[model samples]
Target chain A: MTGTAYVKKIRSGEARLWPSRRPPLTRLDIELTERCNNDCIHCSVNRPAGDREARAREWGAESWKKLLDEAAALGCLVVRLTGGEPLLRDDFGEIYIHARRLGLRVMIFTNAALMTPGLARLLKDMPPLEAVEVSVYGMKEHTYEAVTRTPGSFDAFRRGLGLLREHGVPFIVKGAVLPATRGEMDEFEAWAAGLPGAAGLPSYALLFDLRSRRDGRKNALISSLRTDADEFVRVSRRHGEEAVGEWRDFCARSGGGRGGRLFSCLPSGGSAAVDPYGRLQYCLGLRHPATVYDLAAGSLREAVTEFLPAVRDMRSAGPAYLERCGRCFLKGLCEQCPAKSWAEHGTLDTPVEYFCGIAHAQAVAAGLLEPGEKAWAVTDEAARTKRRR
Target chain B: MSDKIDLDRIYAPSEDIVVREIEGEIVIVPLVSGIGDMEDELFTLNETGRDIWNKIDGSRTVAAVIRELAEEYEAPAGLLEGDVAGLLEELLVRKMVVEKE
Candidate 1:
């Protein structure tokens, strides 16, 4: 072999590979564990870091590897390892390696509190095709620890982030909006912008969801920690005119109601999630007992092919939902989905009033609605015509 | 690096990379370090490159691959040898292709 031929370098966008035809499954979000080192004030799911009962209940390393194998065989190209913090698991490296060996790109979601030198070195050697997302509570010790509720967690997070930086492992930081960290938004944004590999603006979790396990006490704490509608709109607009313009354009293009169909917002097919305990659902948040399939009793193929589509096709028959959410054109603007509803109301169809208020506030701010105008009252024909034009 | 692509050497695609053909084009995704160049996470092959890549079966020597290409395509054996050697050199440097024992 002897001449100077060239290998064309390409970006991911330039390649028409992986799911060139939408395979039945392309992405799988695997919750490695529900445990976290930090007891964040607004977290929806977090078992104690040393909860042996929860640890005992989690599927073993081999079980997870089998699931990853099944997922890869089904044409899954990406597997996201997430949790209260995925790094808490002892065999995180083994599971991560298994997924990568199967040719599935791994994306980790962690609090960055548990990122060690060894883990960072492993990531550097075997890059996680997608960026590891780290959730940042605050920039200062007082504010950060206030949200995490763990003494010395701010320093741990910083030390972990430093290790990732030193080892050249690609990662991005995100923030949560709480009374504790609200004042530090500007600083957080500035720091994130300066960090290498941190793309665009850092996104914040403003409207917190209740626990998937439906812990009422924690749910109440989460509810109290959530930003008000006006505050959400104000904070969101701080991203500047370009972002607001993009939002307006998106609202115009997506203006419509889902009617009685509960899962119309979801993609037609090709995605599902599996919890740490081996229950598979259409998404991580849709933990409704009726919707989740027990993978312990069935295979991944059976769950995705037969069980998931049925759950996705579930319709809302609740009178309240039918009267409001079923007819609201701002459904596209709202974050009120079946999973959110289930987390908040213990039902798949009930409208979350907080989400409804936030959506309306956003709509009004985007100039899509009038003051005091309810979205459900706006006729679809009128809303469509107005938005489309 | 050019001297590394010996005519009698058999080369195979490295185990650290995943290769897939999409719409007739071959895309290579590097699984380990030193394979993908900085920020160029994906590498694609042109028609000529694909032809050469397909012939590197680990069982065939560089000379055999060039001879096979010469018979299939309307090119001189010397020119085909140059093309084969050039591609294998680049792949070798990037660790996308490794010399087999």
Candidate 2:
């Protein structure tokens, strides 16, 4: 009763602060189910939707409610429910309502094809969601289906969008850059801006990362469609200098993280992600077992208190991370991190040259580095300040 | 460490900081710095520090705050004064607190 009343106060903005007048963990990202109907060529982690065994392995609605209750007790205020497609689960309504009852502001991430009339109504009737981020693959039917590889997915996506609009449920549209949708990227953003609740332009991901599970499966087709570092920088520069200006402002305040571990920037050292298998990780792509804690085996209390801290304490493995990424001040401008390293090279410390190339290209474009300057080989005494421990 | 803290000035939390209560502790986020800068550092205040923070509402002098805390906790006023002064100095260095004009 005491905790329930406290949650009520938090929802009404009466007592948002913990008793110590501090907040506990604020956000929990749950990957509901990895089973995606769309077979996008550059897909990073979608196990085929036909895998019944994988679907069976995911934690059910009641378990999720228990976890949400536990999270509320720990002072979690936000829950981001994301997946290959979160709406694939039948118990989505139950889980969503449960999180709301616990006073968490829920954010949903979905491909939008699975969003049905019933779900839209449920979202409308429930308290307004914090955010519902919808992924748009293309501007037309053929282009959309080409990326999703599902023949009628374009129609379903449109229907989903229609339902959200009809119900007046607020949502934002984001796009993935693919060969099929490359030509329509501008049109897509323009249309997204004109949508019901879209704020500015749609944010996009250029470089498609590999599978984080390190499961040894490779998609050469997706790799061929990658927007190279130069193109990424050129496109970014064409947009505006605001991005680079912000990066510079950030670097000025915090010189750079101590170069060793990749996950040091987490909020108050607690922001975490959980996969469909109930494995809690340091972040979305960090699936290394040594760092991943199984919530099914132990309570959320153990995962938060013991396992998370231990994972945070883990050191960088190889010499490259220690020498280059550790001492490098370009983390603000670079995509170098343990998760990306693990995805590209199947090891935590191995450098992903794609990211290095992108960062160098961006550096040159932003006037932070020379035209031919190599990011990894930056030996300039003035540029490469020692990382603060 | 026998120096003095000016007792005449008014002190308060910084304008650009987000004060969060997490896990029975107070965390201060330097918004314009770490957040916009994408830096990963956050400041967490301990128990006595939290108590002192509760009193720094822009209306209290350093001496008044120290005296009030001392009376409330039944501790020596001199010790509380020294602790509050040192805490304020650190907060100033971190830019989490400012001397009000």
Candidate 3:
């Protein structure tokens, strides 16, 4: 009989098939490489795309495949392939196919500069489950090139995006808010809104982080590009009351106090990040020497089960942190996590003043705090509520 | 088209798909061209369908699977044969299953 003759008896649909018991490890972020084709001014983790030494230090496809096998065995269902730009690696397709073969949904973070017809066709044939997230520097060539610093990267990015669209591969674009790209925000938003599968307003990276490697020169450039608290507030207001409402809800849930513990936001052991050199970290931005677990010397299971838990349970003893961020009700609303603190100050617990200013500005805008009033200084809840009203 | 069951013909799962038992449900993800025309790119089976799937070892003939399934459930031989044939045929159309050489 023909295949069509028996079609009516079978039942099939897109349904949730996960077991009731949550997997110990559900998500993994694999940084394929720290190298990128473009040198964006605001980037914190970019190396020269052709840095021979950096390329030599990276694990081969087989090593990455082995990690995927281990991660899959531990019940990882999703793996995000991110990097300075993941497409810089020649073996990206092999690594990607291996992950897909293991039934892990892949989410790619790319600048779209290296997207080729072959890559787009491959993605179209075997979907990544999550949309390929492309970072857009600017809508115009001059503004885009200024941020990326690569002379012809704008055309390359557009060509890459075109390849994705041409092959019917799903993807989305995000922007970096910089002095160079700020003027083109309206243009960027309009263009993004017109793209196929565009969902909601496009997101922008407002708060730029210092270099992960602690390169002083790059950090200086990154700091110079960051918008001040007032500018951040102004740029964020583009979302209007929806953003304010989110902050209000966040405060109501996560406000209050964080005692001495530094990892209140981290889940027990659900997720992990593996860097280019196979060094596993609890979170991506947390590259503090003490917190990084060398995967080459150990296994993913050891890092996930033994090492990450210990790192998460670490508490802060810094007086500056205890006095400011510890008792602050804006702890939930603030981006003053150990990762940000590490990236900014080389310490895990020290509060970054830039993040503090942005958080306080948000609190004031949300009516959760009065202007010039520090969230930590508010001792009386009743008085604070009275001021909020 | 043959009305009679192929008692000696064996069938197996396709290499171009990933079969996973998630949360007690069987999920099949097609590696090429997406999964069974589903927008979400996943194909799932019910309890009975999963039972049939479990018995589709490459070494087992269609008649053997039907016989095993028949003994497990309180069903007639004719009914089991139809059920197994229908499911296999549908899977074949989707390229989720292939006939063994």
Model 2 misplaced regions, further than 4 Å: A1-22, A376-389, B1-101
Report the C-alpha lDDT of model 3 over A253-291, residue by residue, as the tens digit: 775778778987767647899999899998788899999
lDDT of 2 at A30: 91
Fnat value of model 3: 0.26
lDDT of 3 by residue, B34-59 (tens): 45664236566655567788988798
Q: Give Cα-based local distance difference scores for all models.
A: 0.82, 0.72, 0.82
TM-score of each: 0.89, 0.74, 0.87
The local lDDT score (0 to 100) that residue B9 gets in candidate 2 is: 73
Tell me the spans in candidate 3 whose CA falls farther than 4 Å from its real position: A1-20, A379-389, B1-11, B22-27, B37-40, B43-49, B58-67, B73-95, B98-101
User: Fnat of the models, one by one?
Assistant: 0.49, 0.07, 0.26
Please say which candidate is ahead in TM-score: 2 or 3.
Answer: 3
DockQ by candidate, in order = 0.42, 0.05, 0.31
Encode model 2's per-residue lDDT on B45-84: one tens digit a residue: 6566777888988999888897898899888887677667
lDDT of 2 by residue, A1-389 (tens): 00111111122123434544444467789999888878887777777877899998999988889998888777776688988788888898899877766646688988888888888887776533355778888999999988888999999999998998998777878788777887897788789878875677778878888778665545456577789977786666656887766555544455554567656556452567889988888788887667788888898777876778777766786787877777766777677777887777767777778887877776666555678865545655234332311
**Model 1 TM-score, all chains together:** 0.89
